[model samples]
Target: MRTSAREVAVTAELNLSQVRALEVLLEEGHFGRAAQRLHVTPSAMTQSINRLERDLGVRLVNRTRHPVVATPAGQRFMHQAVRALEASRAAVEAARGVGAGLLTIGFIDGYSQAESRLLDRFHSENPDVRAEYRQLHWEDQVAALVDGAVDVSFARPPHSGVDTRLLDTRVVTVEPRVAVLAQHSALAQRESLTLDEIDELEVVTSATAPAEWTRWWVIDPRPSGQAVRYGPAVSTIHEAVASVRTAADSGSGHVLITGESVGQRASNAGVVFVPLVDAEPCRIELCTRRSDHRPAVQMLRALADAACSARAKTGRSVQRGAEPGVGVK
Candidate 1:
């Protein structure tokens, strides 16, 4: 009779570390080297092997030999183990490629216009490659890259975990963090304001964004006001923007951090994006996963580099308006 599903489930609950050791042992054919390969002590390796033997109730190796040889059952198991591991690994890779189909890409909302320019070239070159453009907070952009939700991301560093290759970056002036108000607000009078001037205001912010925006950027003494007041909340940048807009419309003075790119957006909305003259200039970076080695990704990277080089060669700033045909789905 075939093994029951429950029995198989019970047996298949193998220790990841032990399975790793078994893989190393099968590959190395020696206990000492297998231990070295696994970066574990020989005693630990022995214990691992012992556990496997106990679990399976079988002798997997001819232990008397200096270089161990798998028993017939052990050999068969090793082959099956290899196939299982490979299949699982492939599955993980494929899952990670979920965003890989069209290179689900993300960009900061403030810089969407500029980003679209760069992406236009990508689409032109790889017409078959799908493109997705979602506005993401800085931290979410990094997280999405790790989970493979977004294939490529643009932001300021340091981008943690994923493999990142730098693209063009510029240090724009640090102005006051702006107050983005709705069409109707009491403090909407001033076209511009400084960070210190608005420090005491109750700011609207997303739980998704980095704390630095509310803490360091806001003028309020209770820098952690957003987190303490609102707690962890917000799934996207759009939600955060909406929150700010709502809070402003409700007569509560709400402020948000903004750079030159975002400053324009806020200004256009009848909101004042104030600048902090003493603040450090914001640094921008183009980031991508280090592990990603796809043809489309590589091509986009090349195009970005070329665009940067062209800008450097001409000693001119690259403008989004100048980007002829960048597209992101």
Candidate 2:
């Protein structure tokens, strides 16, 4: 009869750090990143792997590959390691004894103020579930939630694979989509803008954001349904706002239509946010996976809905023609 490798590992004196390092290494597929994730040097990760292999009495990783892969024995070890790591997290949470544990939440840009209030509300409402926040890009937040890296996502992914059931979503706040033009631009002084008037200007968007979402945000249709002019792509909201500011004073200027929620926070003297009287509202959804309806997640959802209700009281819904092209860009 052959001795079980799991039993051997138990007797071999593997520590938590070594097991965790291996788990991260496997997940990232590289030493440098694994070390970075653990906030340690690559040399430290190397030593951990060395110590683990010596204790296990096997070459657990195939180093011949550019990014390492687990050997057959290593794979078996990893299967057990994952369960062990999860058990450890569960134990730690249990020890915290109610709301003492941390819930990691993620947010993309443009929702800092609303998120701040929501966090305050969460603790006030449920002091036991401590929360932490991370800033992620539009695409990264969706991926993070799918991988279980983030417990809750503050904004629904504007675009993802067609599995609507993947997320349990609640509308937090719906912002009136508004056009921001450089104050010096031809249409800057307008109190409100028509869809046709908006299409005449060069509309700016984050170049890297999903095009479908961006087009919808900027009101890409000219009322006649022709694609409106797209201006230079700004990589971020800050950059987009700065471009509008520059346009207010520069020879070249562009207009941008985005959520009033964020544009309201921006204080650039050169840019102005005017209501898009006839465009669909931009919906901001607080979402968690369908499988992750934990008490903590449910609490956040409830708080978000409360926030939405408050916002609705002060907010006037705005829309004119066909629903905006896509979604939050």
Q: Backbone collision count in every prediction?
A: 10, 3
lDDT (Cα, tens digit) per residue for candidate 1, span 1-329: 97776675457434545655776676556899778646789999999888877676677788887667788878777666655554454366567655346667777665634455677767886788777777776556565654445667776443432222212222211122344555565545665654444455555554544444344333323333333233224544445456566665665655555455665653444454444443333434455655555677777667666665665566654432121110000
- Whole-model lDDT values for every prediction: 0.54, 0.70
lDDT of 1 at 86: 43
TM-score of 1: 0.51
Deviation from native of the Cα of residue 224 in model 1, angstroms: 17
How well does model 2 score by local distance difference test? 0.70
The runs of at least 3 residues in candidate 1 whose Cα sits more than 4 Å from the true structure, single-residue gaps closed, are 1-101, 107-111, 132-139, 158-179, 182-192, 210-251, 263-278, 307-329
Residue 171 error for model 1, in Å? Answer: 10
Candidate 2 wrongly placed segments (more than 4 Å): 1-100, 110-116, 306-329
Q: Candidate 1 local accuracy as lDDT?
A: 0.54
